[model samples]
Each structure stands twice: as C-alpha cells, then as structure tokens.
Target: MEITSKLLNSANAIIEAKIDAKSIENKLNDIAKITAKKVKIDGFRPGNVPVKIVLDRYKDDLLKDAKQELFKKAIDDGLKDIDKKTDEILGEPIFSKFDEKDGNIDAQIEISFRPAVDVSGYEEVIPEYSTPRVTKKEIEEKINELLKMIAPLEKIEKDVLESGDFAKFDFEGFVDGEAFEGGKAENYILEIGSKQFIPGFEDGMIGLKVGEEKDIKVKFPADYQAPNLADKDAVFKVKLHEIQAKNIAEKLDEETLKKLVPNEEDITIEKFEERIKTQIKEDKFQKLLNEDLKPKFVDAIVEKINFDLPNVIVEQEIDLQFRNAWDSFSKEDMEKFRADKDALTNKREEYRSDAQKSVKLTFIIDELAKVRKIEVSDNEILQTVYFEAYRYGIDPKKHLEDYKNQGILPAVKMALIEEKLFNDIFKKDKKEEKGE
Candidate 1:
C-alpha cells in the first residue's frame, strides 16, 4: 500500500493511493472472515460457512465492500501524511481517478476545505447613513391607502367616464380592418388610468358617457408580446356601461379604524394612526435593507474581501442555478441541450461569473456570521418554517419535511443567519452614526 497527498490550492487537495494485489487480497479475506460468521448458506449451518466459500459465493459484493474500506483507509492514511484533520474537510471527496490494473488499484481523490477569510475591517466598507425616519405625512398617506383598500366600490351617478374612475365597458379591437383574436370583450372593468390596454385605448375612453359608442384609435407597442399586432394601428369600438368609485371616508371613523386593523383590540383613531406609523417605518426600513443598503453592503464586501473558494462548491452552485433556471430556457435551447451534451456546458458557462460571485458571498457571509457571533438554532429554524407554512396555508410538518428532503435546510438556515447578521450590523451602524 502506498499513499501520497498534494495540495492543489489553499482550499483543495488531492490524494493518490495504490493498493497492491496482496493488500487487496488481505482486505477481501478480512471481510470474508466477518461475513462467514453470519452466513446462511443452504449447504452450511448459520455462522459455520467457510471463508473460502464465502469469498467465492459473494465475490462481487465482497470486492465492492473491500474497495470501499480500502478507499477510506487510503484517505485516512493520506490525511495523516498531509497533516490534515477529517473534520476540516468540506463536502464529499471527489474521485478524480480510479482504475484497476493487474490486480492492483490506483485512486486519486480530491478534497476541499473552507477557505480562510480575514474579516477584521469589514465594517469599514459599510457606508455611513442616518437612520431612516417615517414622517407624519407618510403615516397619513398609509392610513388613506388602508381606507381605500377597505372601501366599497359604489356606482357613481355620472354621465361621463373620468380618470381615476372604474369604467366597465364593452370593447372590440381591430387590426388592418379585421377583428383579431383576444381583441373583444364585454363588460370589461378597467381603471381609466390603469393602462391595462394598449396606449391611447384607456385615454380614449375619458369623457365618454354611459351608452355612448366611439371607435378609439390606438397602436400596439413595437415590443408587444404578440408579434402579429406589434407596431400596428388598431381601433377599439367602445361603449361605456357604467362608472364606479370607492366610497372612501374623508375622516377616520371607528368603523373604518376597526376595518383597517382587524386584529387590534379596542381600536381607536389614535391607535390606528400609531399602528400605521409603525408599519410605514418598518416598511421604509425593509426597503432600505432590500433595495439600497443590502446590495451596497454585499457589493462592497465582495469587492473588498478576497479568498479562494473551493472549486467543487462553485460547480455545485452553478449546477443549482442552472437547474433553477432550466424552465426559463427557450424551447430551441432545451432541444439543443437534449440533442448535444456539450450544449449544456456552453449554456452553463453563462452562469459561471454569477455563480462564482454568489458562492463568494455565501462564504463571506459565513465568515461574517462567525465574526458577529450570529447563529440560528434548530428551534428558530423550525419556528420560521412553521410561520412560513401558516402564511402559505401549508402544514408545518410537511413543509419542514419537504425542506429536509430537498436538502435545503442548511441553505434556509444560512439565509436566516445572513438576514440576522445584516440587520444587526446595519442597526449598530445607524446607532453609531447617530452618536448613540
């Protein structure tokens, strides 16, 4: 038996091993001896089968077990020679080469480990900013939105359709002097300014009275989804049926406040205002995290921090991303992939840069999590899963089981940790900026 190890990179290493014929025979005999004690052959009583008979009868199965044992032993011996620990290894070891020749086996296994990262001055990259504050006007606007949401739509006693009013009308569009498919509808409810139809179609309805018929001229945009109608002029024959508007209250009332926040007990105008204020504040904070601060922070860290990622993990990420986006591939591209194996590789290269960045961010977040002492326990994860399940009307246990079966529980936990870590960092930074 011979084993040697080589460092491929800081985060990856390879081990080459060769097992002689005598060593393979010894391993097979050792396994056979163990199997003989538990054997139940027809010609022999249980626990009384000869080792020679056991080796001959289950040669293939025994040889497989022997090879596995030898492989593990080789890894152990190689790790010892390289002064590396088992727990330091990351993911499964990939077998780069495994071949048997002349009753001897040669194997080369590649192993990876988490790269070392120095996140000492990571906070320097975080931009200084004032804490986001919600205003009274914003709170009032949110309250008005809630009122509009709960208000009932009532028929407006008016002759003409107007902007901001709901118009229920019948319309049939024509192209090149002929009616087209999906170009006719009866009693279609559209908000005048909603722009649900092609340009000039909704605007053409303005000032038109109930039972009034008019041919509204419009043109479909060049990039319209339907190529047949793209960049083409069309006339929609329209007849306004009715006009409706939400009967929202100008002032806050007890009934409306109760409707605005159904979960609140003993709701009042003042309490509802406070609730809306808090909600607006929280929403602003979330927007800051999601749209503004988080992206900037991630970009800064990824640019500032440098480390070599394990190649296996990067490949895994690329594969996962490709699988996730498989549905979005064009039919022709999918067919190409099916017809040619290399076509898949060519397509996967498009995601390589993004995958590398994603994998790098993952490791960076991992290191930052440790630096900040951020952790999500199993209970916290389960609680989150249960909350999500209830939100989506799914059974909690089944949701959790699906996550486990799909092998994404760790990814979910990491996401939670990353969110928590970012929130903590941003909050602390805000405090520091405010001289708190």
Candidate 2:
C-alpha cells in the first residue's frame, strides 16, 4: 500500500492511496484464513477448514470484506501521514476517487474537521440594553386576562350581536350555487371577532340581531390550504339564535386565585400579583433577547469574525437551504428550473452566501460554548424534546426516534448549545451591568 495526503486547510485534507494486486491478494488470503478457523463446512472438521476452499466458497463476500479492510487501512495510514487522528474528522470521509485498473486500486478520500474559531473579544459585540421592566398597568392587564380565562359564560339580553360577544348560530355554506363539504354546522358557538372562520367571515357575522338570517359572502384566500376551495367565492346562510358574554369578575377572590394557580397552597392575591409581574418581566426579557439582542450580537460577530469554514459543511448547509426553498417554489418557477439546469444552479448559488454565514456561525457558537464551559446534558435534550412533543400533541418517544432516524439529533443538540452559549454570554453582561 502506498499512501500520501495533502492539507487543504486547517480543517480539510485529501488522502490518496494505491493498493497493488499483491497487497489485495494477501489481504483476501488473510481474511480467508480467519474465516476458515471459525467455519464448520460440510465434510470439514471444526477449526480445520481449508483456506482455499473457504475463499472459493465465499469468494464474493470475502473479496468485499477484504476491500473494506484495505480501504480502512489506507485511510488510517493516510491520516497518520497528514498528522490527523480518526476522531478529529467531522463527517464521513468522502471518496473523491475510487478506481480499479489493471488489478490495482486507486482511491482518494476527502476529510474535514471542526474549524478552530477565535471568539476572543466577542463580548464587546454584545448589544447594550436595559433589563425588561414590568409596570403596574401591565400586571393589571395580565391579571384581567387570567380572570377572563376562568370567567363564566352567561346568556345576554342584547338585541344585536357585536364584536367580542359570543354567538350561538346555525350556518350552511354554498359555493357556486352548491353546498360544500365541511361548510355546514348546527348551533355553532363562535366569537364575533375571533376570525376563526375564513377572511371576512367573522366580520360579516357582526351587526346581526337575534333570530336574524343573513348571507355572509366570503372568498377563500388564493393560498388557502384546501385547494378545491381556494380563491372560490362562498356564501354562508347564518341564523343567529342567541347572544352570550363572559361575566368576568371585577375582583380576584380566593376561589379564583386557586383556579389561577391550581397547584399552589396558601397563596394570596398579592403573591399572585407578584407572580404575574415576574412572568410578564420574564416574557418581556425573552422577547428582547430573541428579537433584538440575539440577532444584533450574532450579526455583529458573524461580520466581525473571520475564519475559513469547512467546505463540506458549507456545501451541506447550502443543500439543506436549497431543498427547503424548493418546497415553496411556484409551479412555473419549478418548471423553469427543471427545463434549464443553469437555472437550478443559479438558484442554489443564491443560498451559498447565507449558507456560509450560517455554517460559520455554527462553528463560532460551538467554540464559544467550549470557551464558556457550557454543556447540554442528554437528559436536558430529552426533556426539551419531550416538552416540544407534548406541546405539539406528538408522542415523545416517536418524535425522538424520528429525529434520530433522520440524523437531526445532533442538530437539535447544537441548537440547544447555541441557545445556552448566547444566554450565558448575555447573563454575564447583565451581572456586570448590575455590579453582581
């Protein structure tokens, strides 16, 4: 075996190896001897099967195994030549060239590693912002919302249905002079301004008196989820039967307090108010972090830092971005790409700059997390996945299995690490700001 390697960059390299016919033959015989010692062939004693017979019986399988072994050996020798370890490689080693000519094999493998990123002075780019402050008015508003959540519905003596009032009604819809599926219901309770129905449907229900029958005309959106009903004009015959409203409490009582915080015992109105204020403050802070501070810091660091990203990782990112964008392309645009190959290439190229930036930031976050000694435990990741699954009404085990089968668990872990990394950075800044 002859092996040589060249470093493409700090994180990438190419290994070229050639295995001659003699080496191939020797490897096959060695594998045959091992198989013979383990096999119990017909008319052959245990651990005494002839090597020649074993090789001839399992010729194809033995040759395949021999080739795999030789390829691994070549890669191992090449890594040594390049002064790299097998554990340092990122993704699977890509075979750029593999050919068998004149009873000799020539192979070339491309390997990449996580690039070293310099996040020194990254703290300087952290955006300065005041901590979120919860006002008395905001806390009161949130309390009012909680009160509404547990409010009882009562029949109202209103003559007309107005916005924010609930209506009990019967409705049947027709499109193009014909009734449609999923368009008819009896005694449906709907809030007048909920916008639960299609566009203009809720607004059309307003200003109707009890026992009134009217036709509400609505057109489905052009991009509606139901293709058959999309962009179609429909008329719903609605008969208002009753009007109702929530009888919200003007004051928070002990019973209502228990309902608001169901698990807590010995809780008082003042403590509940404090809880609401804390929640509002936390929500405001998260919004500021995610929407403003995080984006600004990420953009500044991505623009300020300079490093050569692994080509393989950038290309993988570009492919992912391109595939995701392809799902949203119009039929006409997709057809053009299918007709012209260059159009597809150009479309993919559009995402390359973004992909490079994304991959670069990923590495930066990884290195920064290491520098900060930030780590996400497997249990923490599982808890997050389970929480998300329950939130979306999916089975947690199945969701986790799907992520693993799709090879996205690492991506999930990376996302969590990035979140933790940035949060740590900002929290330290906050501590410093407060002289903590």
Candidate 3:
C-alpha cells in the first residue's frame, strides 16, 4: 500500500491511498475457497463444489467484500502513519472515491486533523479577580420584597376605579361589532394599570364608577403572537362591579415570624433580616464574579492562542448549540423559526463561531490543568455528585449513574478542576498584590 496526503485547508486534509491489486485478488480468492467449503451448490455436496463454479457464483460478492476490507485497512494504516508523524488524530475520516475499472482498484479518502494550538498568557488575557461588596440599601430592598410576598389584598368600596386599583367587571368584547371567542367574561378582576389586557383596555377603565357601562376600544400590537388578534381593533363593553386595594402587612410580628420558622424557637425579625442579607450578598457576589471573569478569560486565551480547529468538531458543536436553542424556544416561536429558514441558518453560523471559541478555550484549559497537575479524587467526586443531586432534587445514586452513562462525569470533573485553577491563580495574584 502507498499513501499520500494533501493539505486542503488549515483544518482539512485529503489522503489518497493505493492498495496492490495482487493483495486484493489473494483476499478474494481466500474468501472464495472458504465459501466453497461451506456453501451448497445444486448437484454437488458442500465441500466438493468446483473452484470454477464457486468463482463464477461468488466472484463479484467476494471482490466487493475484499475491496471494503482493504479500503478500511489502507485508511487505518494511512492514519496511523499520519498520527506517528503528527502525534494526534482529532476527527473522523471522510471516505471518497472508490475506483474498480477493468480489475484495477484505486481509492481516495479524506480525513480531518485537529489543529495544534500554542496557548500561553491566559492569565494576562483574563481580568483580575475582585470580590463584590453588598450594600445596606440592597439588603433593605430584599427584605421589602420578602414582605410584599407575604402581603394580603383587601376589598374597598369606591365610587370610581383608578390605575393601580383592581376592578371587578362584567365585559363582552366585539371585533368589528361581532363577538369573538375568548372576548367576554363576567366578574373579571383586573388591575387598571397592569397592561394585562389588550392596549387601551385599562386606560378606558380609569374613572369608571360601579355599575357604569362603557365601550373600550383597543388595537392589538402588530407583532402579537396571536395571528387572529394581530393589529386588530376590538371593543369591550365593560360594566364596573367592584374596586379593591392592595393591602401590605407591616413588618414581621411574633406570629408571622413564628410561621416563617416553625422549627426554630429563637427566630426573630432581626435574625431573619440578617439571614436574607447574607443570602442576597452571596448571590450578588457570584453573579458579579462570573460577569467579570468569563469574557476576560476567553479574550486572554484567544489572544494568546493561534490555531485552526477541525471542521468536524466545529460542526458537532454547531449541532449541539442548535439543539440547545431549539429546545429553549417556545413551540410558537419554533414555527416562526422554521418559516424564517434564512434567519435560522444565519444563527447556526453564528453559533459555529461560538463553538470554535469554546473548543479553543477547552484546549487552553486542558493545557493549564496538565501544567498544574490538577486532579479530582473519588471522595471529592462522590461529594460533588451528592451535592449536585440534592441541588437538582434528584436521587444521588440515580443521578450519578445517569451522569456517568451520559458521559457528563468528565465535564463535572473539568468544572471542579477549573475552579481549583481559578482559586490558585487568584491566590497567586493576591500574594503579588500584597507584595506590591
């Protein structure tokens, strides 16, 4: 066998392998002999079939099988040679061109090679780490939100309904003076300024007195998801029946505080407030850390690295991103997405670039992990598995098995390693800061 490789692009290679006809013929002859011993022929016992008759009956089939086997062997041998020369095999080989004219066989195959990246100075590219500070005002705001969650609503007798006030009304909506489906309701309670109904609806209810009937006209927005309602005008004949006011409770009392903490006998409003503040502060700190770290890390890594990615890997990443996007879109949005094929295609290409960046980043992270000798122990992995299961409300054993089968265990390990890397880098920087 003889093999030659041509560089098609930075990420693609074309390999052409030529196998000896004599070797192929010998394999075909061996197959024919094996078949003659087992295969039955009319008027002749199994092993007694004539060689000429066996050749006549199974020559084509044997040759085809032999060619496939030889092609695989040639490709494997060629790839082995390439790997020996370059020390890596990145993606699946794409086979093309099989010639069998006049008993002479020649085949051509194409394989994609992973690009080697020279990654360094990722720390310089990523931003410096700074801990986020939680303020007193933010803590107060969170407490207020908690109070509103426990607030109650109260009924009010009023002469006129106003914005921010809940109004109970009986209404029938008409499109062009004709009633439409889902256009009428009795005793419907709506907040006048909530904008929950069609445009101009709540505004028309303002200043409406109980028992007063009025026709409210409104137009649907042009980009409304409902096809029948888009840009359509409708009139709702509303009769205001009642008005209600939102009632907010005062600060947590002994009873309310007890209800919030049934298990803890020593619970107090001040303790609860401090707990809320602490939780809020942790959440804000994590969010700020991610926002500051991710872009800087990617930019730094990309700046230091220069290499082409295998097309197979990029395409695979593109498919994963497309599936993720499709899963996140609503069914209605998906229909609109299918209708706009060009837009979706553009989105796929954009995701391809993101996939490339992700691949490049993975390479850099892996390199860093190797240099730092980062490792995750079995005990640590078990702890992580249990924590993740509890967080997601799943059984630990079942979730761990599922993660293993789905091949996500490595990803979890990588995440753990990356966290360690970040901590180490941050500590080193802190030491330098202290020294300065």
Candidate 4:
C-alpha cells in the first residue's frame, strides 16, 4: 500500500491511498479458503465440499467481504502513519469515493488537522488584576438577606385582608357554574400580594373583611401547562378567615443577634455584624475572581494566539450555546422559536462565530496548560466533584461516575487550571497594588 497526503487548507487534508492488486488477490484467496471449510452442498457434507463448488457458491460474497476488510486495514495503517508524522487528529476522517473497477483499489480520505498555533506573551498581554474589597453597604445588605431568610410570621388581628398580608381562606373554583378539579381549598393561607394563585384571586381577596364571602373571577394564563384550564375563565367563592404579616427581626436586638450567630452563646450584635462582614468579603472576592480575572485571562491568551479551529469543535460549542439559550426561553416562546426556522438558522450561524472564538480560546488555554504543566490531582478532582454533588443534593459517587462518563473530567481539569491561573494573576496584581 502507498499513501499520499495533500493539505486542502490549514483545517483540512486529503489523503490518497493505493492498495496493491496482488495483495487484494491474496486476501480474496484467503477468504475463499476460509469459506470452503464451512461450505455445505446438496451432495457434500460441511467441510468436505469441493473447492470448485465453494468458489462457485460464495466467490462474490467472499471477495466483497475481503475487499472491505483489506480497505479498512489499509486505511488504519495509513492513518497511523499520518498521525506518526503529524502529531494529532482534530476530527473524524471523511472517506470519499472508492474505485474498484480496474483491479486497483484507490480511495480518498479527508481529515481535519489540528490547528497549529503559536501561543506566547499571555502574561504581558493580560491586564493586571485587582482584588475587590467588601463595603459596609454590601455587608449590611447580606445581613438583611440573612434576616429575611429567618424572618418569623405573626398573626394579625386586622379586620380586612390587605396587600402584603397573608389571608387564611376557604375557596372553591368553578367553570361555567360547575366546580373544577384542584380548585377547592379549606383554610388555605395565601399572601394577598403574592401572585401564587390565579391573577384575580389575590386581587379579589384585598378589601375583603375577615368573615366576608365574595365571588372572584379569573382567567387561566394562555400558556398554562394544564390543557383543561389554559385560557379558561373560572369563578372562585372566597371566604377570608384570618390575616397575618411578617415580623422581621431587628438588627440591634439581643434575640435576633443570637439567631444570626447560632453557635455563639454570648454573641453580641457587633460580633454578628463582624461575621456578616467577613462572609461578604469572601463572597465579593470570589465574584471578582470569576467576573474580572477569568475574562481578562481568556482575552489575554486569545490575543496571543492565531489559529483556525476544526469545524467539529466550533459546532459543538454552538450546540452548547443553543442549549443554554433554549433553557432560558419559556416553553410557549420556545414553541414559537422552533416555528421560526429561518430566524433560528440565522441565529445559529451568528452564534457559530462566537462558538468559533470559544473553541479558539479553548485551544489556547489547553496550550497554556501544557506549557505550565498544570495538573489536577485525583484527590482534588474527587473533592471538587463531591462538593458540587453535595450542593446539588446528589450522591457523590454516582455524580462522579456520571460526570466522567459524560466527558466532563476534562472540563473539570480546565476549570481547575483556570482557577489557578486567576489566583496567580490576582496575587501578583495585589502585590503590585500594595507596592510590595
């Protein structure tokens, strides 16, 4: 066999493989010999059939099978030689036409070659990073949020249900004067201002006395998931039983301060405030590390590299972007989106450019990892996987295996490297800012 390669472009290559006719003949003879042992005819038992009979009965099939096997082996050998000469493959090879008419087998294979990029000067190109400092307002806001999470609800002796007050009520809903399923409740506590019920239900509860009964009319949303109720009009007979309001904790009080810091027996308001401040600082630092350092680092590396990416990588990135976009869109809106084929096609092409840039950036990052010898230890990966699984309320071992099978292991490694790079950059910037 002989192979010749021609570069179609930086991203694609064409290889021509020529297999010897004598070799093809030898394979066909070997296949025929193997088939003779299994051949059975009308007059002869299996393995005792004549060679001439076997040749007549199975010659065409054996030849076809032999040719395919020989071609596959030749292609494998050719690809191995190509990879040995050129470092790595970027994508799967696409085979073109095969000629079998004139006793010689000639085939063409098209492959996408990995991009060769010269990546350097990333450190110089990247902007100096600066750590964000937590502010008093931020800490105060965090404390307020924490207080809201632990806020207590107290019963109110109000005469009427009002906005921002919870109303305990008995209600029954009907469509066309007939009751509907899942439309009746007894002593249900619902916030008067919250749109947890149908649109008009909450509004109708307002201005109603504790013992008053009223008929509330509402229409289900057009995109409601229940097929029977979507866009349907209904009347609800509502009776208000009681009213309640939220009693938010005071920041300066002793009882509230103890709740804020549960473990500290003698925790003062000042100590609670200090803990909130510390947590705010840590959260702000992480946010800044993600928002500021990551983009800057990626931009810096992208600027230092120049290469054309394989189409497959770019397509994969585009798929990721599309999935993310689809996730954010409402179900009704997504149905409309799917109907707009031309618009979606245009949007996909527009996203493809962004995907291409992402693929190029990924290539640069991988090169950086190689140059820096960045590696994540098995223990580190396991710990990180377990931590993420715990956050999602999943079993760690199952999540780890799922992640590995889904090819997320490389993504995890890449994330670790990016995190390390960001830390290094931020530390250097901090030192410079402090005049160290």
Candidate 5:
C-alpha cells in the first residue's frame, strides 16, 4: 500500500492510501479459504467447499469484510508511516473515498486528533460567585421548613375553615348529573388554598364551618394527566367534618432536638442548629457549583481561549446533545421535529454554537490538565462512582461496569479532574487574597 497524508488543520487530517490489485486478490483468497471451512454445500463435505464456489457465492460478503480489515490495517500502517499514534486519534476515521478507482484500491480517510491548545489565560477566566452564606434568617427558615414537615394537625371546633387550613370531608363528585370514577372519597383531607386538588376544589372549601354541607364546583384542567377528566366541570357534594390547622414547632425542646438529630449523641439545641446550618451550606455550595459556578467558569474559559476545533468532534457533540434531548421529547413533540423540517434545521444551527463551545472546552480542559500536570486518582474515580451509585440506589460495581461499557469511564474521570482543577484554582485565589 502506498500512503500519503495532508494536514487540513491543527486538529484534523486526511490520510490517502492506494492498494495494488495483487494485495486485494491475495486477501480475498485467504478469506475464501477461511470461509471454506465454515461452508457445507449440498454436494461437498464439511470443510471441503471449493474455493471458486466460495468466492463466487459470497464475493460481496467476503469483499465487505476484507475492505474493513484492509482499512484498519491501512490505518495502522499509514499512521506509523506518518508518525501518529491511535491514542492521539479522537474519533473513528471516515472513509471519504473507498472504491476501486484509478486502477488501485484508492481510499481517502478523514481523522480528528486531540487539539493542541495553549490555555495560558485560563486562570484569568474565573467564575464570579460567593460561597453561599447561611444566615440566622435562613436557619430560621430551615427550621420552619422542618416545622412544616413534622407539624401535627389540630382539630378546630369554632373558627370557620380558612385559607391554609386542612379540611376533612366526604365528597362525591358529579359530572353532568353522574358520579365519575375516582371522583368520590370518604374522609379525604384536603388542604385549603394549597391547590392539591382540582381547580376550585381547595379554594371552594374556604369559609365553610365544621359540619357544613356545600357543593364545590370545579373544572379539571384541559391538560390534566387523566384524559377522561380533562376540561370537565364537576360538582362535588362536600360535607365538612372538621377544620384542622398545622401546630408548627416553634421551640427546639429536648424531645424535638432529639427527634431532629436522632443519630447524633450528646446533641444540644446549639449543636442541632449548627448541624442544620452546615448541612444547608453544603447543599447550597453543591447547588451553586453545579447550577451557576461551573457553567460560568466554562463559559468564561471558552470565551477567552481560542483554538482550531476538530469539525468531526463538534458534529459528534451536536448529534449526542440532539439525541439526549430527543430521548425526552414526547411523541407529539418528536412529530413536530419531523413535520417542521425547518424547525429541525434551525434547531441544529442553534445547537451548533453550544456544540462548538463544549468541544472547545473539552480540548481546553485537557490542555490545562496536561500543563498543570494534574492527574485524576483511582480513589477519586471510585469515590465518584460510588457516590453516584449511592444516589441512584445501584450497585457501585455494576454502575462502574455500565460506565465502562457505555464508553464514559474516561469522561467520568475528566469531569472529576475538571472540577478538581477549578477548585484548586479557587483555593489558590483565596490564599493569594489572604496573602498566605
């Protein structure tokens, strides 16, 4: 095979190879010999099929397999001939010109390589965010939230049902003078003004006294989950049995503190409050990192750094993002993409910018990691995998296997490494600010 290569850009190239007819003939015959052992023709014994018959009978099948093999071999030999490693290749090679052309097995393959980028200005592209502060008010709010979670309902005998009150009742709903399925309940507790029930069902309970019998008219929303009830007006014959209000916990008493921190030994009210504050701060920090800080940092880096991106990598990122989003689309939504061709075309163009940004960021992160001599440790990867498994209630070993099978093990490590890189930068910046 005669091989030659041309650099299209910093991160992409075209490798052209030409094969002699004799080589093709030789490989074809060798494949035919192997095929002979697997064939059992009506007139021939097993492993005794004639070579000519095998070639004639399965020429197309044999040639397809031979072509793939030749392409792979050509790629390996051609890469070595040009001094490139398989590890440096980003994605699969595209056979741009593969056919019997110009009296040779002429093929032109397009390949994407990991882009070489100088991320010197990456440290300057820091995300602007303050570590979320837990205030006394926030702690009080959290305490109130806990109060809501554990609050008991107390029966009311005198005061009329008011908004934010829970009312216990028995009701039979009627649509067009007929009771419907799932429209009747006995001793159902409905929250007034909470909108837990259908439209007007909760609001209609307001201003009612205990033992009061009233008819609440409500309409099910047009886009209701149950198709049968959609946009239907119904009358509920409600007989209020009792009015109940939340008895919120305002003081962290001995028993309440124990209940709040059941697993903590020798815990006090101050300790409980401190623990709650710490938990809230941790939750907010993680949320801020994921939702705001990370994206801002990535965006800032992408804006400041410039590099030639592999077109194939960008295209693959676009396709992957499109597929992941498409998986969530409803049948009707998917039909819209098919019916409105312009919508899909416009959508692809819209995703193009994000795809390019994602690709560029990937290359930038890799370059940063290399320049900084940063490495992701096996223990870190194991911790991340185990944390994910614990979150999703899956076996960590099986989840790790699944990640490997899906070709995302490297991606997982990259994600952790990227996070660690940013965190280290933050730490350095903080220390510098403190003149440490």
Candidate 6:
C-alpha cells in the first residue's frame, strides 16, 4: 500500500492511494471467514459454512465492507502523514479518482478544509446599522390591527351596506343562465372593500340594502388557477340577510388584558404599549440585521480579510440555494435550466459571492465561538422549540418528538446562537461608538 498527499490549493487537498488487490482479497477472505460462522445453509451445520460458498454468495457485500474499513484506515494514515487532525477537514472526502488495474487499484480523494483567517479588526471593519424607528403612527396602527384581531361582531340596524361594513348574504353564480359548481354559498360573511370575492363582486355590493337581492356580474381572470372559470363571465345573485359590524373597545378590559398577555398581571395601557414598543424594536432589529446589516457586515469583514475558499463548499452552497428555490420554478423552467449548462452555470455564478460570504462567515463565527467559549444551552433550545411550536400553532408537548425528528431542534439552536452572537456584536459596536 502507498499513500501520498497533495495540496491542490489552500482550502483543498488530495490524497492518492495505491493498494494491491491481493490485500483486498485477503481482507475479503477474512470477512468471509467471520460470516461463515453466522451463516445458514441447507446442507451446512449451524456454525459451519464453506468459505468458497460464502465468497461466492457475498463477494460484493464483503468487498464493500472491506473497502469502507480500508478507506477509513487510509484517511487516518493520510492525516498522520500530513501532521493534521480530522478536525481540519471541513466536509467529507470526495472521491476524485478510482480505477482498478490487473493487480492494484489507484484512487484519489479530495478534502475541503478551513483556511486560516486573519480577523484582527473585524469589529472595526464590520458595518453597523441603526434599529428601525417605531413611530407613533405605526404603534397606533399595530394596536388597531390587534384590536381587529379580537374585535366583537355586532348586528347593525342600518339598511344600507357601505364600505368597511360586514354583510351576511347568500350568493349563487350562473354562466349563460346555468348554475356552476362551487359558485354558491349560504350565509357567507364578507367584509366590504376586502376583495375576498371576485373582481367587481365585492365592489358591486357597496350601497346594497339589507333584504335586497341583486345580481353581480364578473369576469374571471384569464390567468385564474381554475381552468373552467378562467376568462369566463359569471353572475352572482346575492341576497343580503344581515348587516354586521366589528366593535372594538376604547380601553383594554380585564379579560382582554389577560388575553393580550396570557401570563402577565397588573397589565396597564402604559405597560402594554411599552411591551409592544419593545417587541417592535426586537422585530425591526432582526429584520434590519437580516436584510441590511448582515450582508454589509459580511462584505466588510471579507474585504478586510482575504482567504481561499474551497470550490466544493461553494458548489455545495450553489446546489443548496438552487434546491431551496426549486419549488418556485415551473417543470418546464426547471428542465430548461438543467438542459442548458451555460444558463445553469451562469445562475450558479450569480450566487458565488453570496456562497463565499456565507462559507467565510461560518468559519469566522466558528473560531469566534470557540475563542469566546460561546455555547448554546438545552434550556435555550427548549425555549426556542416551545416558542416556535406555539407561533406555528403546534402543541409543543405533542409535537416535541416531531420537532426532534424533523431536525428543527438543532436548526433552532444554531439560529439562536447566530442571533445571540450578532446581537452581542451590535451592542458592543454601539457602546464603542458612544465611547463607553
């Protein structure tokens, strides 16, 4: 057996190995010997099976297991020869070349690795962004939005329906004087100006009187999802049964206060508004970081520090981004992308900058995490899981196992870590700016 290491680049290395086929065969024979003791054959005893028979029946399986063992051993030997450890390897060893000759086999495998990064003044170079301003108007709008969410319905005595009013009505559609399927509903509650109905249907209901029956004509969009309704003109006979309106309170009631905050007491308007303001700041801070600051920060850090990136990691990033966006494409569009190599390459190239940014950021954050001794806690993970489950209307207790199985738990943990690190950096930068 012979093995040699070659540095293809700073971030990539290749390990070439030449192994005699006789050695592999010997290993296969040993594996066969072990299998013979556990074998079951019609003509053989419980603990006895012919080696030749075992080899004949399981040569491929034995060779596969032998190859795995040999591959691991080869990696260990290569690392020892290079004075490196497994931790230096970024991703798995990619099989670059494999061929078998008469009595020996030659193979080359590639490894992507972390390159040294000089981030001495990353704090000074990375961009800082201002938190989004929370205006009084926005606060009022948000409060109104929340009020709408929990507003009570009240019957109105008004005879005429107007914009922003709710109407309960029965509607049936007809095309060419013939009723169409899925075009009728009884006692449907609809808000005017909501546009929940087809174009001109809800607008046509404006100024309609309760107990009045009328026909609304509408033309379905040419690009409508339903083939049968596309580009078709239809009429709906609407009979308004009731006029309803939403009523919101002037002040937060006791029950409403508890509903607003399930786990809080002594909740006042001032306290609630302050809480909402804090929440708004947190939400805007995250959005601001993700959309504006994060990219600029990454670019600045990258510009300040130069390092080689592994092609394999970049390629993986391109593939991952493409797959993440795969669902947005039509089958025809996806096929075109696959069929046209130039187009696909161009598309991949567009993401090259972003991929490099992400890969480099991962390395920088990893080292910082180690140096700072930053760690994610189990309690934090559980809190994130329960919060996410609650936000998505999943019962945390019931879907705890599901989250674990779906790999959501680890992802949440990583996300929390990233959020925590960036937020700390933001605060530190702000303090330095203030000469603190």
Q: Write the per-residue lDDT of candidate 5 for residues 323-407, one digit (tens) a residue.
A: 8788777888788899999988777777888899888988888888788778898888988998999998999999999988998
For model 1 the local lDDT of residue 163 reads: 89
Model 4 TM-score on a 0 to 1 scale = 0.69
lDDT by residue (tens digit), candidate 1, 264-342: 7887888778778767766777788889889999899999999888877887888989999999989999999999989
Report the lDDT of model 1 for residue 279.
73
TM-score for model 5? 0.77
TM-score versus the correct structure, for each prediction: 0.76, 0.85, 0.62, 0.69, 0.77, 0.79
Q: After TM-score superposition, what is the CA distance of residue 228 in candidate 1 from its true location, in Å? A: 22
Instruction: Candidate 2: list runs displaced more than 4 Å.
Output: 20-66, 98-105, 174-184, 222-233, 253-255, 330-346, 428-436
Report the CA-based lDDT of candidate 4 relative to the real structure: 0.77
In terms of lDDT, the poorest run of 10 residues in model 1 is 427-436
For residues 1-436, could you state the per-residue lDDT of candidate 4 as single tens digits?
A: 7777666657766678787788878888888877778876788888887777777888888778887887667655666755534445565555676786567878887667678776766767766645556678887788877787678777888887789888888999998899988989998988777789878879888899988999998999998878899999999998888887777766647877777677879777777777787677667767877787677767766766777777656666898898888787788867776899886777678688788878897778777767777767888888999999999899999999999999898789778877765565455433543652
User: Candidate 6, 169: how far from true, in Å?
Assistant: 2.4
Clashing pairs in 4: none
Q: Note the residue pairs that clash in candidate 6.
A: none
Ten-residue segment with the worst summed lDDT in candidate 2?
A: 427-436
Scored by TM-score, the top model is 2
Where model 1 places Cα greater than 4 Å from the true spot, the runs are 153-245, 262-268, 330-350, 428-436
TM-score of 6: 0.79
lDDT of 3 at 251: 62
RMSD of 5: 4.8
lDDT of 1 at 196: 80
Task: Give the candidate number with the greatest lDDT.
Answer: 2
RMSD of each: 5.8, 3.6, 7.7, 6.1, 4.8, 4.5
lDDT of each: 0.87, 0.89, 0.76, 0.77, 0.82, 0.81
